[model samples]
Target: MTTDEAREFARSYVRFLESMHELAGRGEGNEVVRRVQEHVGEEGRRHSVVGRGFAPFEQVNVQVALDRWSEQPERTVVVEGVTLPPHYGPVTLQQLLHGEALPPTRLTAPELVDLPSGPGRTTACVRNGLFLVDDEARGRFVLFARAPQPHQGEPVLQLELAGLPTDEAQKVLRELDELRTRHNVYRGQTVELAPEMHGGLSVVFPELPATERADVVLPDAVLARIERHAIGIADRREALRAAGRHLKRGLLLYGPPGTGKTHTTRYLVQHLAGATVLMLSGRSLQLVGAVTQLARELQPAAIVLEDVDLVAEDRGFGPGSSPVLFELLDAMDGAAADADLLFLLTTNRADLLEEALAARPGRVDVAVEIGLPDSDARRRLLDVYARGLRLEVSDATQDDAIERMAGVTASFVKELLRRAVLEALEGEAAPDGVVVKDEHLIRALDDLLDSAQGLTRALLGVRDGAAAPGGGPEPHPHTRQAYASSLSFVAEAGPGLQPWR
Candidate 1:
């Protein structure tokens, strides 16, 4: 037959099929539907066809496949007005079948969407309809449709290789899969497991600014250890791998509440730029395998699992143990030793973790305890958090205050300073010109040390004896002298003079 004749015949056949589909849709053509199904089944038995089903809203994936398939441009067939999976809306299906751009109307409910990368929350919308995307190699347009209800009843993706052999079609599908991976939706973004969707994760693009290493209130030694092992190891992967040491390392940060564990993790995240950061905690830990696989694929990735003891609790002790712990272990063991993956796990209850996980050499190479801030560390924390405060006092008075705050937890120091600023602000009608003074701190301490606020103060890391009416230990004679000097100096220097520590 001539090329024109063959084309006419193909068009005629498509029209006939469409008519049959329409008749069946109206409930008057059961025989036609059966026959079409039988014919499709017979063809499938005769030829090796490459096909996959994607969610109707996953237009980007379908578009990538279509772009890859459109290079040869043999024959294009489109079927429309079909019922798709219940999860898909009618508009999305119509857009996919008609090759029209997706409407701006939101498809995903507000709660279902992951955090967006932009300033405003982004609702899930199909960005484009079926379109061509160019790759270095082959190109092909795809046939995408929402299958008719009472039929297969799903969104279908098919790559038509009109006269090509089975092997050639398989090669095309493989190439398309590679392209899909290259354009992965989650690449370069943080992700968290979605328990609602089994085996799937939701994207979480944290807008957190990178924290400074010095700003983290942990001990210098502990900070140094984490910097060397977790952040530094990721930076010098090539050098370590060349020296016969593997790049994969696990560091566990264990501490009580408000002890700067998470603060340290944020510091590491800031230091390790260009690496994928996977933040998992709570029920999301079930996706350990999926997260590890992604980390392996995207090397130089960091997996920050906060409160890991929730899942890694000692398996032998009671019913609270998580079955996902085994999965976590498998994922850790399965990864290549030199893959440049960093596992940073944090937990308040380190003693509750399984010994196998904690003691294992490759599983946890370094464990750092982020204990309560010591006297000197507490002094530094006070200095760090009070950076912008206008303390109308002399250096000696500020030193006396810091010395009085010694042995307080970092959490207490932070809250104490914040409350002091608030107290200072309360005394002035205009906040623009308010300056915190020694009396403000004294009043703030008095409020916090009230007998009724004992529990609150304890939760904030105030020791039992430290919750006295005046707050902190009794000042020595020299400390009181320094405070008097500070008051005199403040009166002489004027109200806005900034206190130096």
Candidate 2:
């Protein structure tokens, strides 16, 4: 509790006692005063050092008091929440009421008798500088420290080592004994903990598990960029070694849909051995509080947001499409301020991002384009898929259809080949598993063409041309470009900048 709160509680309790005293002075033998005295001086006390009273509540009573308390703000109390690791000790609840910080040093056989408090509830144990008190009945209770000893300007402990001695040891020991005197570690000197102490708040932050690593594949160029960035991080770290500072590196990947942007990010997580990564999708940012909370939770880890266009939508003029995007911008700046953190974003539409956000230099240090797979990449992509299918495509003639399928989108290539393989495995299983045929390829292609046609109409704003007399297909960019180019070549012979239409 704050100093003011302590003063208030003390004032209130004194007033209560004064009222009881006045009631007792009436000389009518009031039951209320009698009960007050019963608890105060008559309060059944097991032991007392000074005027303050101490009572150990039964387990049921303590639980009842804890239950009545509101569980809001989400972080109050210390029951199931503050989990102490087993390595601390096999301490009991009775020992905690006695109030002592647990000593971490393991005791040797010779030093067993030197243990303070004679191995009872008087001595305490703490882990990671956090002290957990074992209540007589309430089990483990984390004691809030009043104020931590100031860490700043503290003396550094110096170590002096010497081998166990014969004659030489005796001489060194005698000299050391004369120079320094041994002191006793006293226990049972009570230190009270207030509820609002900073020590208690320090224990509220949950511990995170170690990150697990996995192998992921990426394009060679993307992998090369990752290596260069890794080296840059190492160089920055070396430069800041004397100052003990960390460096931040951010990369933004922009590309069309069906590209391997997400895969590339996973590859980086695998490559950076000690790095922790939290992957969030753009849709999750739409929630009012999710963005800020996520930013805070993901600090000190690489925050990878996929499909950033969902967050940075086109709101037409200057007004934002979503308030969360502004909050996200603030979060990005906050994350960047920490020298050790990095933020990586992947998006399909670069134009959708705010101009101010996209133009930031250090915010997005390396803006790489994950373009569609080239012919050679397609060849490799097919080979990767073929290995998964366990099919031996040893004959060059047999793979003409597969070769034709490359150079498009990775998603399309993987999906089409997977469907063909599924079709080939309809009947009995063969030694080589069913060999995917040209017919299966044709069927997959037909399905892909239909899907592509729909996508094209949707994206290019093509309609049924219902307004036209014949109801023909609407004019499109590809047709317009082809027709205008053909006429331009004809016109170049004579007229210029005029179309045949």
Tell me how candidate 1 scores on lDDT. Answer: 0.57
Model 2 / residue 189 / CA error / Å: 41
How many pairs of residues collide in each model? 10, 9
Model 2 lDDT, residue 238, Cα = 49
lDDT of 2 by residue, 94-192 (tens): 122222342222211111111122223222221111122233332222321111111321111111111222343244334332222121111111111
Question: TM-scores of the models, in the given order?
Answer: 0.67, 0.45
lDDT of 1 by residue, 1-501 (tens): 999999999999999999866654433433222322333343322443344544322334435444444443553433222222334433332233222332222212111222243234443322212222222333232222222121233223333331124675567657666675665455555544433343333445566766796788776767887898887887777788889888887777765667788888888877886787878887677667767876787777888888877776424224765456666766877899889888888876655553445333357666666766776787788778878877676666566666655445677777878888888878873547668788877777667655567567556655433536544443221222322232222223333322221
RMSD of 1: 14.8
- Measured on C-alpha atoms, candidate 2 has an lDDT of 0.40
Among all candidates shown, the one with the greatest lDDT: 1
